[model samples]
Target: MPDRPRHYLRQQLRWMRGTTVRHLWWLRHMPLRSLGFWMPVVEYPHLVLALLVPVAVLATP
Candidate 1:
């Protein structure tokens, strides 16, 4: 595995962690039902994009 992509991914995850904490703090201010749909929408894409971008780039021949 290339170190660069993995390193980049780690950075992304770190950013996502901070973003998630901040976002969840805001989410707590919203209604419960709003959280059910919105949390996954905001969170999953960050995690997936963080993983997907590095893999797709690293996987390139």
Candidate 2:
């Protein structure tokens, strides 16, 4: 019973590590210029929403 939790934790960590590595590799290979333009929206999503809300309200009929 004690070993079961340890085994489960190891398996979970392996999965998380693999997922993180895969995502990092993908990001590393992606085009940096396009990513740069969108990075701010990802980093400060509230800013994007603040800018969009007014445009959305004005465009509505």
Candidate 3:
């Protein structure tokens, strides 16, 4: 392959890698942006705690 095309391809790959890094960085700290559905469930602690007791009892040794 020619040098210019190979260099361009490498640059494009680098740009893609940079974009992927930025996306992952955002995901690591900005959890709500990715998990909108899960946020509501987390807000209701009492209901969750009530349900967990039965499930835990069922699974106990």
Candidate 4:
């Protein structure tokens, strides 16, 4: 696990990028029941939420 917020986000982004690329072909060609097809469907939004943490933090007074 990452010790700092920056490190965590970096790790998450790396994971998101790597996963997307690794599964790109499968995501494009695999059926709905396939792991690759479902992975991004769940993961992208989760990653985007992770990316919004800083904004959420900064928005608080």
lDDT of 4: 0.86
| Local error of candidate 2 at residue 50 (angstroms) | 22
Clashing pairs in 4: none
Say which prediction, candidate 1 or candidate 4, comes out ahead on TM-score: 4
Ten residues in a row with the worst lDDT in model 3? 35-44
lDDT of 2 at 14: 90
> Cα RMSD (Å) between model 2 and the true structure?
10.8
lDDT of 1 at 18: 96
lDDT of each: 0.78, 0.70, 0.69, 0.86
Using TM-score as the measure, the top candidate is: 4
Candidate 1 segments whose C-alpha is farther than 4 A from its true place: 1-3, 29-61
Candidate with better lDDT, 1 vs 2: 1
Count of backbone collisions in candidate 3: 0
Residue-level lDDT tens digits of model 3 in 1-61? 4369888899889997896576566556666755643444454566678899999999999
Model 4 weakest 10-residue run by lDDT: 19-28
Better of 1 and 2 by TM-score: 2
lDDT score of residue 43 within candidate 2: 47
Judged by lDDT against the true structure, how good is candidate 1?
Answer: 0.78
Q: For each candidate, what TM-score against the reference?
A: 0.41, 0.45, 0.45, 0.54
Between candidates 1 and 3, which one is better according to TM-score?
Answer: 3
Candidate 3: what lDDT? Answer: 0.69
lDDT of 4 at 55: 93
Q: Which ten residues in a row have the lowest lDDT in candidate 1?
A: 28-37
